[model samples]
Target: MSSARWIYLDAGRGLAALVVVHHHLMVFFDHEMAALIGDESLLLRAFRGISEWNVTAILFFFFISGWSIFLAVERLGTLNGIGPWRLYLLQRARRILPMFLLSLLWAGGLSWAGERNFNDTSFDVLVGNLLFLDTPASLRGLWFPPFAGNGPLWTLSNEAWYYISLPVFYWAVYSKIANPLVRIDAALLGSFVVGIAAIGVNAILPNPFFLFATLWPLWIAGYVYGTSFGQTPIERRVIFWLGLMALVTWSMALEIRSDTLRILSDGCILALCVVLLVKIVRWQTQLTRLHYIDGIVRLFGSVGRGSYTIYVLHYPLLLFLASSRTELGGLATSLLGMGMLIAIAPHLETRIYAHVNQWFALDRPRADA
Candidate 1:
């Protein structure tokens, strides 16, 4: 990757990391701070609004992930035929499995350390979390999860599912299929139809699994852009404009429909991301330094570089906040928590990942993975 591309990745990854932090903070500390800060305060409402958009941020990250991965495939395809499928899976597992296990253990340990009752339900949660299975619907609210334990692991599972399934997508849509564009179009159309069907079922059945199907478009969109990244500046510009429009339309939809709209909104946002990423790759400029802002972005990026580690360790910290005696102010608590994580991220990457990697036999030197 070019230095410019690294800069773009750093910016997005930093923003994603901070959003993940805020998402956890809102669940753990925001509610407590609301009463303390003033129940009817505008500041509280503002915080609440941002909190509600955490899922949107997560969806954006997924979109970016898709775009990045597709670009990788494109780059590789020109060289050695994109290598072997088994090697790809092994690399992905090495990348994700260490962090996933650590997060699970972090959750289990928090339950023990915080003196939370680890009943039969807790045991089941540990297993479910470890296996990346859907948490029993019964435990959904047993404890607030976003900030507490490995709640973020849910996304990891989705990501893993996507990674594992990519080969099939490549074969079915982009490679083996006689007409790749037609296959892409058909897949997207079928996914949207499925999403609409899920919405219908959700009206009576309330199954959120339906939402998982919606991610197909985002993943495919990312693949398409990634495949085309180095083709030409004009083509890149086309993707960029399309992505921008998708984002604008999605934002407008958010105002129009809160429930069902997110389904389509996310799809549009995913497509928009591909375009935006293509533009970034083609047109690059350095940010004029804004003293503290640059410093903070760099710090966030440093922590984000070990996103896997920070993500794994973050839940335990949340559980600590939820169960501990400290009654921290919202802003103060959030800043402190982030500061600690920023400080600890390097340590986790260095020492903790090693410990977690033992079981998975994933302690390969960072460069190899």
Candidate 2:
């Protein structure tokens, strides 16, 4: 791995992955939570507000993935020794496919035990998911009768689809477009413009899920913005403040079913992407008394080494917990549960990948320096 590249992208992925965990925590933990928040208590109101806007976290993943992939290609291309494509694909297969398949079985089993009628009607959709074709339709139901019942899988499918298609997309922008800088500029400008247009169109058609399709352009925007605009000191600070402002503004705004607000929210997410990208480039993290927090981040990053497993396996575990309803000792219980999953997931994920590689005969590739 390129040490410089690894430093930021790994750290960014670490943040994005944690956001995913936090987003899910809000979902699973929020039960009669609105009532618990006393009318006058600002703290409880803030907590409720964060949980309601949890979807934004997944969008962060999409943007980061785009930026990271572009940089990976750029660096590897410059180095001239690494087989970027091979390395990328091997890692992708190891990280994504095994866990995805395992989750299918796990979810299927849970469905059986719970006596929840698993509709196999959308066999085509299942196949689509199996191949990541479902990504473009990520917000839609997985199976006709909502067989899997895991909303997160859609993003995974979207992620897989992005990985599968990125080579062609990268080549188009980086090679076929003739001027890399120009293409990057267009991608950056076009994503927000098109995103707003999409929102307008969706308002007429009412595709709440149509926004999932924006993942592609949002990602490409990050890629373009990173490649074309180097992280200058002033730019970094500006982007950080802009991102923070957007987050704060969005948090303060009341919910209104207006396309304008949706567009603004998307823009805010774009800004946040810029901030995170700049932060990684700066690498100015101070080691405070948050050693435990640091350790948790480090642990999650390691488990994120095989996050595909955790992502895939986690829903079933959560479903079981939800279904069983065995008394978890409140907020502490939720944290502990997530902690245990983080601890075990990495090891099990690696083992599962080993078997997957063997089964697929994927271990024979010689790493050509």
Candidate 2, lDDT over the whole model: 0.55
For residues 1-369, write the lDDT of model 1, one tens digit per residue: 534444455556656666777777878776676777887999888878777766666666666677666544443444225466765677577767766766666666666677563333355555555554542232211222222345666667557767777887776555655554455455455444554565456445653354444455565555565555555753444365445546654775656543554645665665665466545634553344346645665765675566656655776766655656555544565567767876777666767556646856743423111
TM value for model 1: 0.72
Residue ranges of candidate 2 with Cα displaced over 4 Å: 4-8, 32-50, 71-94, 115-125, 131-147, 177-180, 190-212, 225-264, 267-273, 276-300, 327-337, 356-369
Which residue runs of candidate 1 sit more than 4 Å off their true CA positions? 31-49, 71-83, 118-121, 135-149, 177-211, 230-264, 270-274, 277-299, 327-335, 350-369
Q: Model 1 Cα displacement at 142 (Å)?
A: 14
Candidate 2 lDDT, tens digit per residue, 197-259? 555565566432344444455566555545644445534444544455456436633555553
Candidate RMSDs in Å, in order, are 5.5, 6.3
Model 2: per-residue Cα lDDT at residue 236? 49
Best by lDDT: 1
Q: Which numbered prediction scores highest in TM-score against the true structure? A: 1
